[model samples]
Target: MKKIGKTLKSACVLGLSGALLVCSVGCSSSSESSGGEKTGKKQLVFWDKSEYVTAYNDMMKEKVDEFAEKYDVDVDYVIVNSGDLEQKLAAAIESGNQPDIIMGDNTSVAEYIASDQLAEVSDVLADIDLKEEAKPYAVFNDTEYLVPLSLTAPGMFARQDVWEEHGLEAPKTWEELKEQAKIINDPDNGFYALGLPLGESGGGDAETFIRTIILDYGGEVVNAEGEVTVNSPEVLEAFKFIASLYEEGLVPPDATTWDDSGNNSAYTAGTVGVVFNSGSLMGTLKDEYPEIWDNTAIFDYPAAEEGGQSYTLGGANVFGIFKTGDNTETAKEFISYFFSDTDFYNEMVEAIGGMWQPVINGYDDTEFWQDPDNAVWLTAASNLTLTTAPAPTTDTAAQGFSNHLCTKALQNIVVNGMDPQEALDGLEADLNELYQ
Candidate 1:
């Protein structure tokens, strides 16, 4: 865990594009051709919005060169900011000059699939065994379209020192979590029980928390048949639970407007005893806050009820081929190579740190994740589950996720004093329109 200067702060800016940045490196060219007919060579244009640290980019560039040499194809790779990815890719599509392959967030992948802009990569699916966390984003309309590269999830993490001082163990249920929070909360001294990001600005983090709670409470945005189910008792339960946290002053007072990084920033700044977050926070603690790192321990999301199950909300970075591009085969080949090259893939995964988790099945069994130093991150990743995983109930779930619909409903209840059922009613109406 090398100390990068405020890694999450930089990522907060980059992720404003609606997805966390990963390791995206590419070669650049001015060729406007979408076909594999660039001067008698198999030419492929690839777009990546995972602009991270220079080391990540450099590693990617090395892989690209190796790929070009092995495949005998010319690749035009460009790094684009995720915030601008949608507009840039849409503009290219409109101008009839789109990239052959794109690596992006699940939200964008779903949109491309919905719009029929992506080519099916059944061949790639045939070769790689995707983990359960990767499956939801990999398919569209029962056809494999996305090649998932990595996984991420938000889970409960606590300061072990704080817990030990209070003679407490890591909580395993929501009731226990609340009890523990009460013991640790010290708002006047700038210490909070939990770092819950109830903010509405950063779509992914806020929605991840809301959705996980809804799922555990047996609520879902839609059912298997694509009908809206956002107004269920389970949804109200989840909403009420979140509101209790705010009204009780367990979380920060300014949490209502904080971005996704709010909780991470709070936790890193030593203001929170526990937090539900991705591995990035752990990475920061390991590097910049060594004392905190020594005291940090991660656990699965607390169960919604006694003896009931809970899950971390999973998201992915995926590579998808565009139907508009001419070198679909070449694009697939590149992705296939990336997944098959285990040594390089493992190195890349380690280099990127907690920003990503392996989507491939066996990667977790490896030393990189198995090492004690990576315990917090590995625990978080191991508990990963998609908001709409096992199967998506609605085609619009991805769109709803990007729009932060559930998050807003939460804000309505907690910040505006709206009745839980009333909030659900509005959410249900909007979801009906989306799923219909």
Candidate 2:
């Protein structure tokens, strides 16, 4: 229900102009025409993120094909690798030939908004039936720019049988988790209790993990007023605590070099006792590793304090329309058509097998969510703390996150053997530079 009258247009003009000047050099021509007309028919170009689960991407292709056939439009749908999307998008934007719609994570969406490369989609949101919780994530500066497609969060996947063999219940608090980890962590036997990644190779997993801990310890990188506060006592404590985990050998020795798949591979290979990941890992286990899936129990992150709320770092996967395209209206129409059928939408959500949560309401009665494992994701979706929790969801925070500042700080401490306070001071300086 937020409104932005003319500021949206003015901001878009300023952002697009700046981006064009910055990226005008050495850009390649895009496949589609500027007017999006092909063979005497209107065309729609879409760039979708390649999901971890192949079925998700396959189903999306089916949906796109169906939409194209129904609308009689020439559709150019491309599935791009998530890691390569940012550079590709910038190049397209520079050439003024970006796609009509692009599916991206929250960080990418924030970058688009910051660059004024996205069209305001408040009307698209108003026409759809959205969950109240999904609203905040799409809005910035009192205007909505993206339409959320699905929700995801990181949850603790633990080896239930191992914990049972030791006659222990699941850990409920961070302290309990460490204690349990210390007891069950048998490095000589090739089993580590925590498969947490502290590396910089992956996509923001380490950053997300470190931020979750910082928030857990009552630290804030930037306050609500947008002032840099990452150098506080709470952040120093959080940094020291994370360092202690690596020092105590609770984490794997090679965890320093892990990419996004490092923890997933460790857990799936039966060398790790616990991992924090999205439901994509759950799908992988269910289909390919049934025996391990049977032993796996999905739990929320342990509370930082006893009897306190547990926070998961997550947000929505959204569709953002670029301002550089001429098929904005057609793109919006496709989105409406995509969600128009209740049964089809439900099937899409169920096809991923709990990897995606519903952003629209009225899915409470779905039988898929009644399963205990799937239900855990449903609950975590509602209890998420976004990467920019303490501060507003601004472009600066997103840029900092995309820059992997948090993971770099951890590497400075755990890998480079820098003092925690010194690492934090460096982090504070970097964040303040971004904010300014």
Candidate 3:
């Protein structure tokens, strides 16, 4: 694993946009005195991202309760939606009331680390044995701020019955996908070939899709030294190719306006032949729409060209300790306890339908990962390209991803009909501004 450290050119300044609305789940406030004083017991505030699987949240609540009893601490566990976490966290930081621990995606961690609000937890990571692929994403500037909890990646979900009816097989490359999409697209029958989102809303589904394409086409947002390199010919080609998908009507027309759940909703509704998302969609299908789940087949992301290298964007879902509050040690202890029971952790992952891949080395060899229906997720986790690849995982790149710059550029071309070069130029300027 490579350890990278760099002085970020700029600090990310988060604007306080709205009031923080936190939803508490299985919370206990009895330990606090009327005046908000701790009643001779340590209090730990934890914010967990709401999972798509309700059982995962429920299991975590049970674990938090157990930890509180085991460690003699009062815990206030809040479940925050992934889309609202950044804003709520920003509010908490600005008000000097941040939680002791937060669980979120890598982009949020990088943004917070850049703002100097996260505490280095390298000591906490030392006790856990992590997989080789999970190690690189945990370190920044030779310091660790996030403890990885699980892995997630976007996989191509195709309608097997639809493909079979057309005598087609799952596509293995971008050209094949487009060709198959053209043949199977039946807009008259209310089925589009693909459900690629280009919208700027939600937590960067559009950005993830576009960035994977940019890298697969040999483009880089930045070089290894963290220099801006997005305005090159390769990037321009990538932009044109993506815009061509919308232009040729291969993707849903409203994909430009979709939020994070747009593709999931479309896939569930059987309006699109294929969609790219994590296993959360698969879990949803199995539980709510088993008929559709029965026909859905997951595949690795298609390569940019025939016989070319393929890439998918993903990273570990991590736990970040905040520098705020006096409960840093308490938070670390709870994290250790959370992963202490290897059996329970493995069971929880299986219960969640393997939507959350294991970050520990030996956890992946279990029967759950070997199941054919669940193996694609394991394959994706094994070969993840962190959101900020090519460039070191720096605050600047993280902020760019959080801002959805790539998606915005694609929207400018596909939605507004701006020239691809012009959009790429604007994207370069915006990214350079962030890096500067």
Candidate 4:
């Protein structure tokens, strides 16, 4: 298993002076004015992974500037590459400095919750509305600390022309998807039905897709005892389905080692006819290759097996205030501001090219989604509940990285003739041991 905290260990090791620490937190204030008045604007420092960094450039900076002007508080955005965020946060937490607010993986939120770093929403966020899609992340010990932003997962996409020419409609069931995939797997036509990347990309996609299928087979990642349920007949069914997909030649040969961007490349190169993809991903295809973007069509994941939920695993970005500094109040205010700030939210959507519903209730219906631009993504997140975790057992299973592991397990099953049941069963055992 890949160790998570080894690199972060050095950065987070305590005993270092505050001046020597690298910060992952933004703005917060826990101190009452001691003997003097506070001066200057309250600067809230924030950290997010790299994709959001590009988004901040996409008018997010301007939106913060606008929020600063409107609320009279300076919002400082700290951009960190997504891969390095955990290490940075670990380091910061070690030295008594953490971001005022952090937005990263949905699964990762459990780690923050386990630490003393987070502030319970309590009455502070009581007024903020939440979507059905986001509330599952907050149900820890019957309390919540996160305000969800983006709800994302892969969906099916196709070249409209190919579907029209072949007279194939969107597949709603696994059987149909396989049948359609077989028809489109013709190498002579320069088209493949799916983008095969068995590395991390394939791994994650495979896990979620299979998990949904497992659910179809009456399987779940955990059992009634709150332990793993991966080694069951249901999971075996899920494995059997994936193995069938590979053995039947529905997936491309290079899927086992395809790089990060390989799937999208296949779509852009017009080498694929159908795929499981997302609307947020479309922006790249559009900007880099508008023609491919035009040919692209986004849909939800097809049923990999009969009786499956039209589902994808639950995933979202959660923001939290760290347990550092005297800036706790400032941190809470920023969370409230970030969640409720109308202008900031809009700019966030505009910059990131992804939509994050505002935290306040009913805010999702706030004309923003209805805009022509948001139509596609809004749909992607709409029916996502079918794939979400049952309450009381959400992030605890993965400790914030289950999706990552599941994805990897999927990759193992996709190529190499690995058994899905054995792969998931092993993954379940390891994951259970981590938190056991």
Best-matching candidate per lDDT:
2
Per-model CA lDDT versus the true structure: 0.77, 0.85, 0.84, 0.62
Cα error, residue 416 of model 1, in Å, equals 1.1
**What count of clashes does model 3 give?**
2
The candidate 3 region of ten consecutive residues with least summed lDDT is 12-21
Every candidate's CA RMSD: 13.2, 11.9, 12.9, 10.2
Q: What C-alpha lDDT, on a 0 to 100 scale, does residue 380 get in candidate 2?
A: 86
lDDT of 3 by residue, 34-80 (tens): 21365667779999999888888899899999999988898999999
Model 1 regions lying over 4 Å from their true place: 1-38, 51-54, 375-383, 389-394
lDDT of 3 at 428: 89
Tally clashing residue pairs in candidate 4.
29
- The deviation in Å at residue 403 for candidate 4 is 6.9
lDDT per residue as tens, model 4, 257-292: 665466767777778776565454566766788887
Task: List where candidate 4 sits over 4 angstroms from the true fold.
Answer: 1-43, 52-59, 66-75, 188-190, 201-203, 223-225, 258-260, 304-308, 343-368, 371-373, 386-388, 391-395, 400-403, 407-416, 419-421
Displacement of residue 428 (Cα, Å) in model 2 is 0.7
Model 4, CA-based lDDT: 0.62
For residue 226, give model 3's deviation from the true position in Å.
0.7
Against the true structure, candidate 1 reaches a TM-score of 0.86
Q: Count clashing pairs, candidate 2.
A: 0
